[model samples]
Target: MKSNILTIMKKELARFFGDKRLVLTTLVIPGLMIYLIYSLMGSGMMSAFAPSEDQIYNVLVTSPSEEFVAAADQLKLEITEADIGDIDSIKQKLRNGEIDLYVVFPEDFDQSIASIRVGEAPDEPLELEMYYSSTEVNSSAAADIVFSYLDGLEESLSNLFNINSGSAQYDVATDEDATGMLFSMLIPMLLIMFLFSGCMAVAPESIAGEKERGTIAALLVTPLKRGDLAIGKILALSIIALLSGASSFVGTLLSLPKLMGGDMVELAGIDAGVYGVTEYLTLLVVMLTTVLVIVAIISIISAYSNSVKEATTYITPLMIVVMLVGLTSMFGNGAPTNPVLYLIPIYNSVQCMNGVFSFSGSLINTVITSVANIAYTAILVVVLKKMFDSEKIMFSK
Candidate 1:
């Protein structure tokens, strides 16, 4: 029994790995593409978050006071005074990239501060409104700098009045919380994508390509049981998909520091060592079962198609659904507490991974998801076996 399955698996593996072009496109190219794409995205994010060193910021002020003007000059900002009525035009200029930011000081702004300094409170609090285009890099940087300057001004006024605002409070988030946030937000979605891409790369060729080339008819005539052939094909495709997934996984881990703004110490505010042995084990279990499910789905789709192109076309909708399901982690707080939801296949795997990463994992749900996935794959294998036995499916024109 084992010999037949092994023979079939070996045949599939040899057929895949023996071809240099297939190996390159399936294994090597995916990792390389992910690294390049993610690195470029990270670089773009970094550039967007900061302005160039030589960039000069343009500023417009309304009813500027002597102290405010001094502050602007100290910061080396180019200041222009516009009428309050020109606020709309200034905003339009900001949107058009003609200016970086605009600041508006309330009427009697200096008098309000004077009252406060003389130990008399004003009837209303003094207010300043700064407007800037967040979509523009220079505008965002200028806004941050101006906000810092305002904070300093506020601190100076507080010191002049001897006002005590109490001690500073630091962030209370622990390493675990940060790690959970990062993992829950990133890993589940990425895992799903990688698993699907891996399976998509190979499953079509294993099933649909063989059908298209009429090689499946040759295999069907052999002494191998139809069930054995189905299992062997699935098992072989799963292994290859797992390797492809692993390659993509490694690429993501290596480029994560670059992806998270080039800071390895902090990812979504979490440091390394957030995940331990238990977390890794949980991830392994979820990933393995998830791969099986993905492979089964792809294999079924490929078996139904007459050619690799048709197989891909059939699987595209499934890929979109998987991607959409993976995105739930981004918006959800964590895994759902309901155990019934754990039986929902791909969605369950995603939520379970999210739960495990966030420290909210339920062992019961994990077990259920794993078992359910295997059970579902078994049903799919039965369907595939039937498809294998059908002459119309195996040798379709």
Candidate 2:
């Protein structure tokens, strides 16, 4: 039985490595894509993080006080004051790259303060309008900064009048220094995506490829049992998935130079002590199980498929679901922390990666996730074994 298994393994391994196109799909092409992606990312990161050259903030302040106007001028902003007329045209110009921003002061802006002091309706809330290019996230941020300054000024004035007010508002951010956090989340997502794409890329060839060349019949004629044949294909497909995952990782690493930077995204919040050997082992276990689950999915579909085309069409949705699950987990920052999260297959893996990035990583969570993943992989393997046992897979036209 051992020799039969090894023999089947050797044949599948030989077929995969021996094929030139498969080799490229598994490694080279993915590597290039990763490099290109990272390089572009790096450029953007550099531009965003790098100090601005000739940093002149062009702003249009509408009906703003001389004191407010002077403050902007002191900060090296070219302040253009204009009435509310032609605001639409001004926004168009901003879009056409005519200016950086248009800052508008509220009409009856001073009266709103007076009304609030008397505890009446704020007839005019301090409307600091910042019209910037909508396409740029940076422009939106710059607008917010300017508005915040004006807001602070209003608050200070209110305080001078002893105007009792409710507590001021503030926004809490989780991504203030999210370097490694981004990477940890992105890496697992990329892994899942590449694996999915790789499965489709190789499955047709792995299954339909055999049928096309009449190799399935030849293999059947041999003493190698049907269950063993299924096992061999699963093993072969897993290798393809692994290669694809590796390619994407390489691509990501190369792209990092472009997508991020030389410093990487150094999250100050996480401590180094979290990444112990035990944590790494847990991660490895999850990764392996993840791979196995994907393999089982492919095996079931491929066995039923007459050609790779049919199998691919069948499995694309599964692939997309995996990618989506991984992405959804990344945004679960506000999700209630629980041990059950660690028991939920891919969800567990996502949380594990998140923990891996955090300062105080949870050892218990990692172990639970690992155990759950292994259990899931075992279940899938058994399911695949049953599918292989079906005589239809062996004898069907």
Give the clashing residue pairs of candidate 1, or none: none
Off by over 4 Å in 2: 38-52, 55-95, 101-187, 253-277, 331-348, 358-391
List model 2 lDDT by residue over 254-328, tens digit each. 566456555544433332333568655655666666666677677677767777777778887887788787786
Give the per-residue lDDT digits (tens) of candidate 1, residues 126-170: 889999999998888888888998787677666655444667536
Q: Give candidate 1 misplaced runs (Cα > 4 Å).
A: 53-135, 158-170, 263-268
Give the top-scoring candidate (TM-score): 1
What's model 1's overall lDDT? Answer: 0.86
Error at 334, model 1, angstroms? 1.7
Global lDDT for candidate 2?
0.67
